[model samples]
Target: MKKGLIRTMLSAVLGLACAFAFAGEVQVAVAANFTAPVQAIAADFEKDTGNKVVASYGATGQFYAQIKNGAPFEVFLAADDTTPAKLETEGMTVPGSRFTYATGALALWSAKDGYVDANGDVLKKNGFTHLAIANPKAAPYGLAATQALDKLGLTQAVSSKIVEGQNISQAQQFVATGNAELGFVALSQIYRNGKITSGSAWIVPASLHEPIKQDAVILQKGKDNPVAKQFTDYLKGPKAAAVIKSFGYQL
Candidate 1:
């Protein structure tokens, strides 16, 4: 009996050692719009796989620049499909590692109630003193917002009143903090539980702008990293898909 007990304890120790040997960390660069969902997904992934994810959130364009300069991210979740595809072409990422993870929706939002109408006529009414948006050059949401404005013929009219944020999160902050009357932001930032939590918002129609197809790719540095590949696969699984949908993004 003593011999059997000793063997059992040795097996347990070996199992624990194996688990530790396989565990690893994946460094992720996530787009600001995906922050909440990605964090939740990462937590779920760690719980299930015993691996760790260290994520940094920022504008996709900025992440692109950093990746070009050899940032040590294993995976990149971009806010648009174009950037990832561009990286793949430039040899910064594993060829064919790119895939659309989510299609984001944009909303014109205000921190105050009754400011925005259901049809988004607020843009035409020109009742607000300042309008906030992410920098079109840096953020996909900003580019979408610009496209929507141009489609509505409000680009020139609202040009002087525009306030630019560094990213979508900051643009939402501009409205939330009263820095601007209203701004275009990612729907995920202002939505939860199938409803808008605060203020008024107009969900921009998909027809107004090009689809914001958010994509993910394994960077060249992570080509052989098992944890990185697993994280990317986890993102396409049901658990991660559900979490992403909860954040107002369409998969």
Candidate 2:
């Protein structure tokens, strides 16, 4: 019995050792708006699969520039589907590895309660001196914010008081830190579980702007990295879907 027990123990230890030895890492560039939920998911991914996810967060447009310049990113989780589709057309992505991983929602948010009405009437009121928005030239959410403003005929009225952040995360930080009285941000940033988790927000209606369809793709550099493919597959599975939905993303 003692010898049998020793043999089983040795086999288990060897199995674990082999798992660690072969475990690989994937370097991912994630959209800034997805920072919170991705971080949470990555932790679970690491624990469950024994593979490592090294993530960098920023505007999707900026990540595109870096990828084109040969940044060593294995996977990309972009803020919009167009950017990933563009990369595929350019032959920079692994064919048949592209998919829409999430669809995001935008919101007008403020650090103070009652600052933004549910109907988003605060923009017309124009009570605040400064309003924060991401750089429309580089962030998809920023472009959506402008589109919403145009639909409401408030672009011209609020243009003078606008402050730009290089990315969505920074735009949200401006509002969070009182640098701007209010800002347009991803609903996931301030909401969860059918409620707003922070100050105040008005979830922008989809009719006000284009759908924020976010996509994921494995870049050419990652085509040979098995872990990259694993990570993307993981994103499609139920566990990752739960995290995405919890963060207010429409799968």
Candidate 3:
């Protein structure tokens, strides 16, 4: 009886050790525009899977350059599909690992009440002195903002008044802090529960620019890491989708 009991305890210790060996932490590079949703999703992922997620948020373009220089991120969630596709072609990411996770929307927003009109006519009226947008070179939202401006024939008219942010979050901060009067930002930043939570905003029409199809992929460094693949899968699962949609992104 004593021998059998000792064997049972030994087996339990071995099983626990194996479980610990299989569980791991993943380093994820996430786009700035996905800040809110990714935070919530990461928390949920940790709770559900007993795995740790270390996230770094920044412009997708910046992340792209860093990844090329051998950044240690195991997973990358980009603000645009193009970067992931480029990485795949460049052999920087695992082939067949890329997938569109969300479709982001752009918005024209102001901190002051009634500063923006429903039809976005405020741009034509030139009511605001400064307009903030992300840097087109680094942020997909910035590119969309420029495309919308070009489509509206306001690129030249408002070019001088434009203030550039390094990322969508910073662009939103410019408006939120009243630094630029109004700015283009990701809808996710200022929206929740099917309503604009603070200030005024105009959701940019999809016709104004190319679709902001945000994509995620496992980097080559993570191709063999099970936890990295699990985290990527979590982003596509129903629970994460709910959190994403709550932030105003389309799945």
Candidate 4:
């Protein structure tokens, strides 16, 4: 029995070796809010399929412009489903290769512990001088933040103190670096395993904003690339789903 098990293990190693021998890279355009989970998923994907991922992270609208202009990205992971649908309508993606990968949530976060209350009452208190947000024109999270403020009847009060970032990552940076006392950010940026990872945050109620259904698609540039399709398939698998959930994204 020991010898039989040894042979099985050796054969598995050889099979993985063969898979790696033909490994190639796929370029992916990823929305900034997905950075952490995607990094974890990509590592698992490479281990499982022997394909290298070259990922570029940025705003969905920015990625949209790049993809439309013939960027080398083979796959797109957008912050909102509409952007992927837009690309499909524009003939920039492979037909029937798009699907929603994750649902995102927003949070009002402060780098200082205990600054943001559990119910997010600080926004109405108007105690903070600066509030960072992603650019609403380019980021879905920013639009959600705006919508939440509108719902709370604080849009006019918050607008004057708003500081905008080109992407969600930069918006988080503003709070982390103390450029802003507190700001709206992707919940995935600071949450893990059903809890906030650092500082303080209030996960915004979903009713305040439209659903953030993030989508993934194989771009037209990857129509002939097997790895691009493989990556997209892997993203929908249980392993990737676990990572996404760990980062506060809903699958």
Top TM-score: which candidate number?
2
- Arrange candidates, best TM-score first: 2, 4, 1, 3
All candidates' lDDT scores?
0.93, 0.95, 0.94, 0.95
Off by over 4 Å in 2: none
Global Cα lDDT for candidate 1: 0.93
Instruction: Please provide, for model 1 over 33-138, each residue's C-alpha lDDT reduced to its tens digit, 9 standing for 90 to 100.
Output: 9999898999999888889999998899999999999899999999999999999988899887899999999999999998999999999999889999998898
Error of 3 at 238 (Å): 0.5
Off by over 4 Å in 3: 1-22
Model 1 residue 78 lDDT? 94
Please give, for residues 148-243, the per-residue lDDT of candidate 4 as tens digits. Answer: 999999999988999999999999999999999999999999998999988999999999999999999999999999999999999999999999
Q: lDDT order of candidates, best first?
A: 4, 2, 3, 1
**Could you give the C-alpha RMSD of every candidate to the true structure, in order shown?**
2.2, 1.1, 3.3, 2.2
Looking at model 2, residue 103 earns an lDDT score of 95
* TM values, all candidates: 0.93, 0.97, 0.92, 0.94
Model 3 C-alpha lDDT per residue in residues 169-188, reported as the tens digit of each score: 89989899889999999999
